[model samples]
Target: MTIPLVRVHGVDDVRLDNIDKPRTAPGDVLIEVLLCGICGSDLGYIGMGGLGMTHPMPLGHELVGSVAEVGERVSHLQIGDRVVVNPMAGGNSIGNGGTEGAFSPYLLVRNVAADERAVIKIPDGLSVDQAAMVEPLSVALHGCRQGNAKAGDKVVIFGAGPIGLCVALCLNYLGVERLVIVDQSSHRLAAAESIGAVPFKAGSNNLGEFLIQQHGQSELMGMPVPSSDIYIEATGAKPVFEQIMNTAKTGARVVVLGLHKQSVPLDLANVLLRELNIVGSMAYSDEFPAVIEMLTGGKIDLQPIISHRFPLSQFSEAIAQASEPDEAIKVLIDCQC
Candidate 1:
């Protein structure tokens, strides 16, 4: 038997091809992918061919699936059980670094019994779409954890994209006193507003000035400008990074969640003077269960952020839609459809 899968051959060159169905080895698990989300990093890989990819690469990481076959040694999961896959287990993250991903009819979870972090069973009441979102929400949760956002803290997120919106939602759920989201897209800002974040148009006004006018100046001693307790740079835009670095409050925790395509010069003096705690967050580890719990408990809603869905065969169109910041928030690929 063969399976249909999507792979990137070159820049802007993604194609669907058929390959042999993976044979179930002892201790392996076969998953029938249900849903997968197209992330910004996937777009980057599609557009640039490889940030470091030396060969054709599979694309997609945010995914949920059901077990189709379980190896003899795989005792934790049985056929027909729904699960959220952890792509990063054993340094073999799906859709990244040459690992084949969930953008296919099936996926083989190799050596599942060996890695305790292999997969998490989705709790009841969470739809497959919601379960598919666990990966990105885990990313947002990790970023929030890095920032150390606490109750009554004022937070500013510099991007209203999916990750940014997720960050806003996580911060709000953490009992943030005030949450502001900055983005140039009205559609995205509106989405952010719907989630209880105060949205600010990035180009219409200076971010610092707008925050001061809306939230009033910061009262922290020795701080020269109005600022938020936590500043999250989620846009990966160099200018946005520079802007936040220059205007963030003294002793603020700056969380970097977005993947920067290129290195941008940082104002070391400002960083040193303000004593900003710049934290870099990578893909999640140990945060998936918390995100799932939050979803199950109604602490956060991811449905609204999923603005578009496309069948796996329409991945090109899905990628195009995901590339448009004004038109889509989180674009999903319905593998089971």
Candidate 2:
């Protein structure tokens, strides 16, 4: 039997092709993909023709699925069990280089048995669609954890994209005193506001002035400029970088979550003068189960952020929608639909 899958051949080249169904090895397991999200990095890979990827890469990491066939040696997972995959653990991370991604009808989990480290069983009452979000939520949770966000601290997140909104939601759940999100798009900023974040239009109001008006004078700057306890950069834009450096308060924790495509000059003097602590967050590390608990317990709501959905066959349209910040927030592909 042939399975249909999405493959990227080169820059701006994505195709739905039929390939042979993968055979489950003695210790392997096969999963039927239910839903997969189009991430910002996925768009980067598609646009650059596998920019940082191996050729003919299958591109999907945020995925949820069910066990179709458990290999002879596998003991933990049973057939028909719903699961949210942690693609980072196993060497064969679906959609990355080591293994084929969930873009296909089926995925082969090589050698790793179903466990908390590799996969987390979706709790009762959580829909598969909601489960598909665990991966990105974990990413956001990790960033918040890195920033050491605490109760009563003011947080200013630059960018209202999916990651930024997720970070905002996480911070809100953590009991931050003030949560503000800045973005150029009113559409995207509206999504941020829906989750209780104060949204600011970047171009309309001067960020520093707006912050100062909303909050108060920066202790370090001693001027009418906003200074936040925590500053998160999620836009990956050069100007936002400068804004963060200029507006951050002394001793502020700056967490960078966006993947900047180009290099930007850093203001080392500002860092030295203010004694700012800057940190970079990557994918995630051991934060999945906490995110799941937050979702199941109703501490965080991700439903509002999912702006659009497309069938697996319409992946191109999904990508296009995800690419437009004005059109969508979190675009998902219904693999089984």
Q: For model 1, what is the error of residue 197's alpha carbon versus the real structure, in angstroms, after optimal superposition? A: 0.3
TM-scores for every candidate against the unseen true structure = 0.96, 0.95
Count backbone clashes in candidate 2: 3
> Each model's C-alpha lDDT?
0.84, 0.83
Give me the displacement of residue 295 in model 1, in angstroms.
0.6
Q: Can you tell me which runs of candidate 2 are displaced by over 4 Å? A: 51-54, 114-116, 221-224
Residue-by-residue lDDT tens digits, candidate 1, 1-337:
8777888888889887777888888878889999999988888887887556776788778899999999898888888889998898855678886457788979887878788478678877888878988898889999999988888888899999998998888888888858888999999999999889999998896767788875568643565577678889998888888888778777889898988879989778778878889989998879988988888987777766999999988888888899999899999888865
Give the per-residue lDDT digits (tens) of candidate 2, residues 68-168: 98888777788888888888776666676555878777887776664436756787778877888899989998999999999988889998988999899
What TM-score should be assigned to candidate 2?
0.95
